[model samples]
Target chain A: MTIDASMRDALLGAVPSLRAFAISLSGNVDRADDLVQETLVRALSHIDSFQPGTNLNAWLFTILRNLFHSEYRKRRREVEDADGVYAARLSTQPEQGARLDLEDFKTALARLPPDQREVLLLVGASGFSYEEAAEICQCAVGTIKSRVNRARTRLAQLLAVESVDDLGPDDQTRAALQATG
Target chain B: MAQKRAREVAEDVVPGHVPPAPPRLDRNAQARLGEQLRAMYDDLLQQPIPDRFIDLLKDLDDIEKGKSTGKGTTG
Candidate 1:
């Protein structure tokens, strides 16, 4: 099911969700939007590759995730992840004392050593099954599980959350996360 | 001090499940959270699509069409 005439608006309509997912992945709105734009262009160009009835969101996410890693690799030398630059930049404003702790989350997430973060974001946040994430990340299923578990543990420590439950309480956010998780 | 740090860390990680606060999403709080997320999404969706991106797509389509023509011409 290519993104032909009927699917154009429908696919494009996934932009908000895609953008939100990108922000979750990238940490900021601007970068997330850029990622969405890139994903759209790529998806449209390779429209034939997209099956009509399959999960368009998941497919688009796979593309965006791949592009993010590629871009991250290209800028590996020039940009430093040091002292949580990427994480810090991704942090959203906290709400009074009820802040989302974006910095801590970002730092923790960023420190996840790409492989784990990739798996976690895909499996934990993005709602991709371990199988799907494995396929996307090009790793074995067990590897994806380990990465997710490890990522969860690491995030727990970073966010200082006692358990994963702590992070999953935001209903809307959780719902959003579950779609990709 | 140690306990304070631990508590703070625990609170930070736990969204609404900590002992100090119930995890229930009050309508007001839920509304606020929704507003925040919506605001963020709205801001993003409203962003001007970069001209370069638009241009890039046009170029790609043209090239693809050109390739198709070449194949037909040769065939």
Candidate 2:
């Protein structure tokens, strides 16, 4: 069956977040948008299979993540990114030093294993609860938690963020300090 | 050695003011990292959706409607 009006609107509403997740997971805008296009195509064509009243965002994210794993490395041969688009985006954000720090964080993010990166994005960034992230990843909540933990640890190492001060440019730093201090 | 590092941390996080102690570094770091993750993702979210996606969805809507009227716009 073709996409109905509601489903069409739903799919369109989901495109931006889906693209954000895709971009974060893949670390390449071009590839991420390609994945988003393919995902929308797949979702619209397979509207029959989708169960309504569920979390549509999570569903789209699952599709995008699955597409990345199934075809990302094979299709691109793993050399397609490092194109400086991400770095270019960072340079426009803030002061010179923080921008460089953001550049390092982005590189560190890219270095994470895809699964860890996906879980991290799902739970840490995208506002998905551990349970929702688990459902999207088709794993247990515990597994999702672990990946988030490991992803954080490894990212800290990569960014050389030995302590709170080293986590450069975060406004949340004060709240975190207050909460736990 | 640890105290010195904590002092440096205080200077960064509280600059010119001293903290009672080096407020547990690990948790604060986690929060900061997560903050950065969202910040970066927010950048991606801020980007305009490419026209290709908009056009593709529009085309799908047109095709779906056309199919019902016996005037399919599948192209």
Candidate 3:
């Protein structure tokens, strides 16, 4: 298929999820934006390869995931240093950090290993099935499942979200954030 | 050498203790975590798409008009 109006819209529609997934992987908004931008550029230029009537969102996700890995490889050490600093900052945060704030959620998400975070976001957040996530991630489905399990376990631990009460009243986690301040 | 042999024999005779596993989330905890994950992701999804991206898509039409097919690698 080639670039058409609907296809362009499809690409646009996929951007927010792509950016969210990118942030989950890179843990920095700036780098995540750049990753999404590059994914868009590649997807637009190579629109011919995209099969119409297939899953456009998954295709875009695969593109972004691949780009992230390649770029992540080249900057692994540099990225790890930045992560060390970020982790240190998180360590010093207050105990009430588990109060269901989006910032708290993001901080906990950042602590996850990128692979684990990627699978977690793919399956848990982005609504990809295990098989779809495996395909996007180019791994076995079982790998995706295991990573999701480990990622959630680690994330919950970091957030100190022990029970439903930790999620706050009425099961409204985000609502709790609004209620707090 | 005698002390070392004695220590080795003593250690070798004792059974190793297995460490306890970390507590995994029960179903309720997992469900709540799922809610939190979706909340975080939905929050991002709901945020306004930045102008840079909107403009980039608009500019893509110009680039697409100039090309018959894509070539070369991303910059």
Tens-digit lDDT track of model 1 for A1-181? 3333356556656665677567766666677778878888888878888776787877887898898888877877777666666676665455445445434455667666777666656655545787787677665665565455555555555555533333334666444433334
Top TM-score: which candidate number? 2
Ranking by DockQ: 3, 2, 1
* Ranked candidates (TM-score, high to low): 2, 3, 1
TM-score of chain A of 1: 0.78
Best by lDDT: 2
Q: lDDT (CA) for every model shown?
A: 0.61, 0.72, 0.72
Ranking by lDDT: 2, 3, 1
Residue-by-residue lDDT tens digits, candidate 2, A33-133: 89999999888777777887888888888888888888866866866755554545434445666566566778788778777788878877777878888
**List of clashing residue pairs for candidate 1:** A1-A51, A1-A52, A126-A180, A126-A181, A127-A180, A127-A181, A128-A180
**Docking outcome class, model 2:** incorrect
DockQ of 1: 0.06
Model 1 interface RMSD, one decimal: 10.6
Q: Write the per-residue lDDT of candidate 2 for residues B1-75, one digit (tens) a residue.
A: 698446444544553564333233376577667667777778778888799988998898898788877964467
Q: Give per-residue CA lDDT, model 3, range B1-75, as digits (tens).
A: 697445434443445622122466665577666777787678678878888898888777667666745564466
Looking only at chain A, give the TM-score of model 2 against the true structure: 0.77
Model 2 has a DockQ score of 0.17
Q: Each candidate's DockQ score against the native complex?
A: 0.06, 0.17, 0.18
Better of 2 and 3 by TM-score: 2
